[model samples]
Target: MFSYRVEGTWRRLKRHGWSRQQPTRRAIERDEDVVDVWKKETWSRVRAPRWSVGPGSSSRTRPGSR
Candidate 1:
C-alpha cells in the first residue's frame, strides 16, 4: 500500500483549476493503456472476497477480520 501527500505539480495544477489539456489521439490511447494497467494491478492486489459475509463478519461482530 502507498500513501501520498496529494501534493505535486499535477495536484497543484488540478487545484488551480487547470483542466485536462486536449490530448492528441496517440496521447489519449496511451493514457487509456496506463489506466488499464493500473486497474488490473489494483484489482489483482485486492484481498476482499467477491461477496460480503453477513453480520457475523461485521465490525461489531469481528475484531480485525482481515
Candidate 2:
C-alpha cells in the first residue's frame, strides 16, 4: 500500500511536465467599474479592424495556392 502527500504529488506532477497556473493579481488602485465602462464604450470600437482582407484569405492557410 502506498500513499502520496500533497507536496509529493505536486513534485511528481512537475517532473512529468505538468504545471500550475496562478491567477494574476490586479493592482490595488484598479477600478472594475471604470474598466467595465471602457470595455463597453471604447474597447469595441478600438478592437475593430480598420480594414479586412476578406474571409478564408490567410496566407498561412494555403501557401502558393491560386
Candidate 3:
C-alpha cells in the first residue's frame, strides 16, 4: 500500500472526476402551504401587541384606593 496524504488523495480523486455525494434534503411530514399560511396569520397573532393593565382596569389591588 502506498502512503499518501489525505489532501493528495482527495486532489487525485477530484482530478479523476470523483465528487462528494450529498444526501437528498427534505422535511418529513411537512405541509408547505399550511406552514406558509400559519406563518402569515398565526405568527402575526403571536407577535400582536398585548393589552396593558392599569388603574382604569376593573382589578383592584387596594380596596381603599378603589
User: Best lDDT goes to which candidate?
Assistant: 2
Alpha-carbon RMSD to native, per candidate = 10.4, 9.4, 13.8
Winner on TM-score (1 vs 2): 2
Query: Which candidate number maximizes TM-score?
Result: 2
TM-score of 2: 0.39
Give the least accurate 10-residue stretch of model 2, judged by summed lDDT.
52-61
Model 2 ranges with Cα > 4 A deviation: 1-13, 16-18, 49-66
Using all chains and alpha carbons, the TM-scores for the candidates as numbered come to: 0.27, 0.39, 0.36
Error at 6, model 3, angstroms: 0.8
- What value does the lDDT take at residue 57 in candidate 1? 37
For candidate 2, the lDDT comes to 0.86
lDDT of 1 by residue, 43-62 (tens): 67885767665544347767
Count clashing residue pairs per candidate.
Answer: 0, 0, 0
| Candidate 3 residue lDDT tens string, 1-66 | 799999999999999999888868767878999999999999998986988765463456755344
Global lDDT of each model?
0.70, 0.86, 0.83
Candidate 1's error at 19, in angstroms? Answer: 18
